[model samples]
Target: MKIYKYKDSVYCDEDLSCEYDNYAGDLYDLYLDLKEDNKCGETTRYYVCDKYTGYDEPEELIEEEFSDLVIGEYESED
Candidate 1:
């Protein structure tokens, strides 16, 4: 399946190192959700990568769900 990854600085200043992969959904939908939160401040920023990743969930898996948003190559946590 295809999925997207994104990053956001929510409910805090970008310089605070609070940015993380904290949201999941369509870009616009996520943006609106953040906007409604109001804690992210007016300058909160959202970023969507340019390539989509192929994701496969193990049939017996129970951890991590799927997200649909902008496309991007998956980055290693390392």
Candidate 2:
């Protein structure tokens, strides 16, 4: 699903798919940009992934905060 940044909550684009129902919360690793892999290819821009699951909900962050939400290359190795 294509994720959207509006206000402070990041949510799955309602127009994208139902895999997420406009979910807006803490994602362990929220990829600000894109990542490529051998298996999934160019998938999962934002993920509350297995090993990367968050301990708490993310607070309202501004667009500038995207840098702080970085998901390292090795991190998204799902």
Query: Top model by lDDT, which number?
Result: 2
Rate residue 63 of model 1 by lDDT: 14
Candidate 1 clashing pairs? 11-40, 51-71, 51-72, 52-72
Could you give candidate 1's per-residue lDDT for residues 1-78 as a string of tens digits?
A: 222343442222112123345534433343445346541222222222232222232210111222333343334345
| Candidate 2 stretches greater than 4 Å from native | 1-10, 13-17, 25-61, 70-78
lDDT of 2: 0.31
Lowest summed lDDT window (length 10), candidate 1? 57-66
lDDT of 2 by residue, 1-78 (tens): 235443444543233223335445332223332212211112233223333323222222212233443322121224
Global lDDT of each candidate: 0.30, 0.31
Per TM-score, the best of the predicted structures is 1
Compared with the true structure, model 1 gives a TM-score of 0.22
The superposed Cα distance between candidate 1 and the true structure at residue 13, in angstroms, equals 24
Q: How accurate is candidate 1 locally (lDDT)?
A: 0.30
CA shift at 45, candidate 2, in angstroms?
28
- Error in Å for residue 41 of model 2: 37
The estimated TM-scores of all candidates read 0.22, 0.19
User: Residue 37, candidate 1: how far off, in angstroms?
Assistant: 0.4
